[model samples]
Target chain A: MNLYDIATKLDASILTPKLDLSRQVHCAYGADLLSDVLAFTRPSTLLLTGLINIQVVRTAEMAELGGIVVVRGKPVHRSLQELACACKIPLLRTRMTMFESCGRLYQSGIKPCIKDPGCECNVCPSV
Target chain B: MSAPLCKKEFFVQEFDFEHAGKAASDMRKLLMDYGFDQQIVRRLAIAAYEAEMNMVIHGFGGTLIMEINFEYIELVAKDNGPGISDLKLAMQEGFSTASDEIREIGFGAGMGLPNIKRCVNFLGIETKPGQGTVVTMRVDLGPDAI
Candidate 1:
């Protein structure tokens, strides 16, 4: 689904609406670890994270993620909002917990970002 | 072996979470402005970012130098912090030395170096305990880059 659809389905409040909401996102990854998000996420995938630091936005920018949905009703700081806006990454906030948000998004047809079974990267044992 | 097409440097301060990824983001923008391949630019950006974050989280600040040549782009991150005593241990996926404060902000899960290695064409580390560390990452500008 597109970002706007996800926002509407989750009843999220858009923190950065200047970005194009019609951008399509094929997958989603929920993680609080910035490194894990960097390691596992695919390009243009949406990120559902609990962290509201500027690094979250920076990580999304570096990984080229579609957007960010800050879960758990956390207050997004002004710096985070400014960076998200400058990067043109859509930022959303929801009162729902990470699990609930993930479940709802999954029910709405958003696929999870997963490693390929045939992948050969041996660094992470979880892979 | 001629002069590079472009060269730039950025200073990263220790524990500077506020502006940690600026260098890497600037590098990505520079590559995009240079019209490099999007995939290659993305990979380089990830590598640079991981390196930048490492300096912020672990090291005592550093400088990031980028040299964009016709055939390749290289990023060298040097930090003057407590160097890694065990390079092998530090390279592991789930091993981290970051403090509780660092983890509170969603970092220190020990995926930085591996993520950098996963993104770049070549990765090199040089460190001296109690002195500093330097991470060199390179990505070629060709179809074989991955």
Candidate 2:
């Protein structure tokens, strides 16, 4: 799905709509642990996170994630927004819980960002 | 002719959450501008950011240096006093020494060093208790660098 579709499915408000929302996201990774996200996530994947901080944005930037969906309606810090804009990564906020957001996206055909046993993408550890 | 070795240094302050990953971001941009492969650039950026954050969260801040040659990209993060007491323990996954405050901001998961090691071609650490610590990470460039 694209960023706009994911936004609609989750009822999320785009915090950085000024940035492009037409990018395709084939996979999604949901995690609040910045370390885990950095370690396991793939490029251009959508990130579902509950945390809002500079590090979160930085994680998205370093990982080259396509977009971010903040769950549970957490108020995003201004610095986070500014950095998101600077990094050009779309930021979305949803009132739904992380579980709900993940479920809705998964049910809509968004695959989990899991590394299969036969995967050779050295970044992610074997499942 | 081989490209000249390029180097840049950034100073990170302890608890400076405001600009924690600036160095890493800047280094990534520099490497990209130099025409490095996307995969190599991303791997170097991840390792650089982890090293930079390690200084901000664990040590008394430090200087992060990025050196790029035709063959490899190297990142050297040197921090001030309060070095690692046990290198072996620090290298293990899920072995962070960060406090509650750091954890609340979505860091300190004890995966920094391991993450760096995974992203880089070589990882090295030198520390002296009550002195300081230096972490050196390198990612090779070329066809098989990825």
- What's the DockQ for every one of the candidates? 0.65, 0.87
Write down the RMSD of all candidates, one decimal each. Answer: 2.5, 2.1
Note the B-chain TM-score for every model. Answer: 0.94, 0.93
Residues B73-109 of candidate 1 have per-residue lDDT tens digits of 9999999889999999999989999899999888889
lDDT of 1 at A76: 91
Candidate 1 residue pairs in clash (backbone atoms < 3 Å): none
The lDDT of model 1 is 0.88
- Residues B41-123 of candidate 2 have per-residue lDDT tens digits of 88988998998898998888999998877778888999995999999999999888899999888888998999999998899
lDDT of 1 by residue, A1-127 (tens): 8988999888999999788889998889999998888888878889999998888999999888999999988999888898999999999999999999999999989988876577654222233
Best by TM-score: 2
Stretch of 10 with least lDDT, candidate 1 chain B:
B137-146
lDDT of the candidates, in the order given: 0.88, 0.89
Model 1 TM-score is 0.93
Model 1 ranges off by over 4 Å: A115-127, B143-146
Q: What is the TM-score of chain A alone in each candidate?
A: 0.90, 0.93
User: What's candidate 2's DockQ score?
Assistant: 0.87
